[model samples]
Target: MLRRAGLPIGPAEILAGAEALSRIELGDRQQAQAALRATLVHRREHFEVFDQAFALFWRAPSAPGEAEAGEVELLDKAPAAARRVSEALGGGASPAPPKVEARPDMALTVSAGEQLRKMDFEAMGAGEIAEAKREIRRLALPLAARPTRRFRPNAAGRRTDLRATLKESLRQGGEVLDIRRSERVVRPPPLVAICDISGSMARYAQILLHFLHAVSNDRDRVSTFLFGTRLTNITRQLRHRDAEVAFEMVSHIVPDWSGGTRIGEALDRFNRDWSRRVLGQGAVVLLITDGLERGGPEELARLAAATDRLRHSCRRLIWLNPLLRYAGFQPKSQGVRTMLPLVHEHRPVHNIESLRSLVETLSAPQSRARMPS
Candidate 1:
C-alpha cells in the first residue's frame, strides 16, 4: 500500500530490515526497540520499511507492552512519508479527496479540477504524468444530454398568458394557476484534435496523447489525428481503457512515428478525407504543432489554406504551439506565419496549464471574426 502510495522502498527491503531487527539482542524490550530503530534509521531508504516492519514486529499478538504512541503516529502518517518521497523525486502526491460542496450538482463540480489542469508539463516527468493521469481519472465527467429548462406557474410575472390560463380554468371550473419557465442548455460541441508528431514535436507528443486519451474516453464525438510525413488517424486506438495499451496500439498503427513533417500534405488529406466526416455538428479543431513545415512556403501555404477551409467548416479552430512557451517567441518562420493567421485562437501547448486553457477555449462560444486572409 505504501509503495502504491508512492513510497520508494520495495518488499525485499522490508524483509531484509525485518530480518536484521530479528537478530538484534538487548536486555530489555525498550532497549531492543531502540536497537531496532537505530538499525533501521541507518539508511534513508530503510526509514519507510522500518516504520512498517517495526510496527508489525513490536506489536505482534503476544508482544509485551502496547506499541509506542510515536510508532503508531508514524504508521498513521505513512501517507505523509510517501508524499515526502514523492516531492523529493519531483512528483506530486495523489490529490486530496475533494471537499464536498452543497449545491444542485455537487457531484459534477470538481474543486481540484483547475489545479490539475494548471500543472506544468516541462517540470513534470513520467511519474508526475502518471499521477496527473490518475487525477484526470478521478475528475472525469460523464457525457450527459444538455440541460432543459423547467416551467412552473407563478402569480407575479411579466408577459402573462391570461387567455390560455382562463381557457383551461373554464374547462375545470375556475382554479388559480401559476407558471415559471427557463431556457434549455446547449449541448457540448464535438472535439477534434490534430496533433503534430514530427521530429520537432516528438518530445511532447506522447504526453499530450495521454491527455487526449483522457478526453477521448470521457467525452463522445472526440476525434484524434497525428501528422508527420502523412496523416494518421488515432481515434480508434485511443478508445481502449488502459492508457499504456492505447499508446502501444497507436504506435503500432502509425507507421511514420517520428520523421519528416509534411504539414501541407497531411492537412490536404484531412481537408479532403476527414473534414466533412468529423468536422460536422460544429466540432472544434485543436491544431497542435510547432508550425514547422519541411516543404517550403508553397506547401506550407497550401497546408494553411486547407486549415483555413477546415476552420470555416468547424465551430472553432485553435492552434496550440509549443514555441509560444518561449518568452522570446516570434512568428519568424514561414510556416508559423502562414499557420498563425488561419487559426481562430492561437495559444501555447507546452504544459498542463496551457492544456487547461485549451479546454476553457473549447468550452467558450465561437468568435465571428474570420482568420486573417
Candidate 2:
C-alpha cells in the first residue's frame, strides 16, 4: 500500500515496521498506527496517502481471524483513493482486456480535488475545507462596470458635443466641419456584503468568509460586513494579504461571533448607519443569511423597513442562503416569507461551485434577477 501510494518502502522498512508493532501494546489503534507510521513513513508529504491506507486496512474486527475475513470485505468497500491504490498495486479485481484502440489512462480518470469541488461545505472535513480556502483565494471577482452620467471625449460617440466641436473647429483654422463626441464614464458598482455569523451559520460562515476575503482584495469598492447579534465591518481586516492574520484580526474584533441571530437589529443598524455611506453610486448588495430572524413584536416591522431601504439603495439585492441548497427547502419561516418578495434575487451559497456561479452572475447584468415593484 505504501509503495502504491508513491512512497519508498523496502524490505528493511517492512522488517522495522514489524519490529515497532511488536514493541507496542497493540490494544490501542492509535498507538499501533503511530508505531507503524514512525517505522514506515520517512517523509512528511506522504502522510495523507499513509493515513488513507491505514484507515482502509485497519477498519476491521479486533479479533485476529475475524479481521482477516473483514479485510477482504474492506477491499471491496474501499473508497476511491484506496481503490486507486489497490489497482496500482495489482491487488484489485482483474482488469478487462484492452480494446483494439483504447484511450490513454489520463483521458478516463478524475482527480480527488475535482470531486471535492462539488462537495457541500457543511459536509467537508478540516483538510478539505483548508484546500477549499486555497481554491477560493484563486477566484477572480470582476463585476460588470456600469455607465455613469460623467462624460469623456470619444471620437466615435453617438452624441455630439457642440462646445468641443467649436473648439476643435477653431484649432482647425475656423473650418466648421469637424465634430467632437463624448461618452459616459463606466465604472464597476460598489459591492456590499452583509454576512450572517450567528451560531447556526458558524460552519459555513468561516468558509464563505474566505470567499469574501478573496473578493475584498481582488477588486475596488468591495465592502464586507459580518453580523451575529451586531454588525461589524471587516472589509479593512480582510484586505490583509495574509488570510490567517486577517481572520485572526476579525476574530478579535467581532465580539458577537457565534452568538444569537438578530437579523432585524443588524439590518436596522446597517440602514441607520452604514447604508448611505457604502450603498452609493448604484451598489450591489449580497445578504448572506438563512432568513431565520429572532422573535419579537418589533422584529418583523424592523426587518421590513430595513430590507425595503436596502433594496431601494442598491441596483441589485441578492440573498445567498445556505439553506436553499436543500431540494425541499421552502419559505416557511416568517423571516423567509418576508424576505422572499423583497430581494432582487435568491441563490444558494453552500459550496465552491455555487460561489463560482455567483462570480459569473455578478460579471453579467442582473437581467434574470427578479426585481420587486
Best by lDDT: 2
Clashes of 2: 0
lDDT of 1 by residue, 205-316 (tens): 8678878898888888899999889899999999899988998898778876555788888888999998888886567788889888867667977977887888789877
What TM-score would each prediction reach against the true structure? 0.56, 0.67
Candidate 2 per-residue lDDT, tens place, 1-373, comes to 6654545465666899999989989898999889888877764544555666786556554676775464456555544444444544445464586775856688677777777778887556444667898998899988878887788899988889988999989977999887889888889989999999876676678888888888888888899999989899998999998889999999888887656788988998999989889988789999999989967768988888889888998889999999988988988989988888888889999998889998998888656459332
Q: Tell me how candidate 1 scores on lDDT.
A: 0.67
Instruction: Write out the backbone clash pairs for model 1.
Output: 152-179, 152-180, 153-178, 153-179, 154-178, 154-179
- Say what the RMSD of model 2 is: 11.3
Candidate 2 lands at a TM-score of 0.67
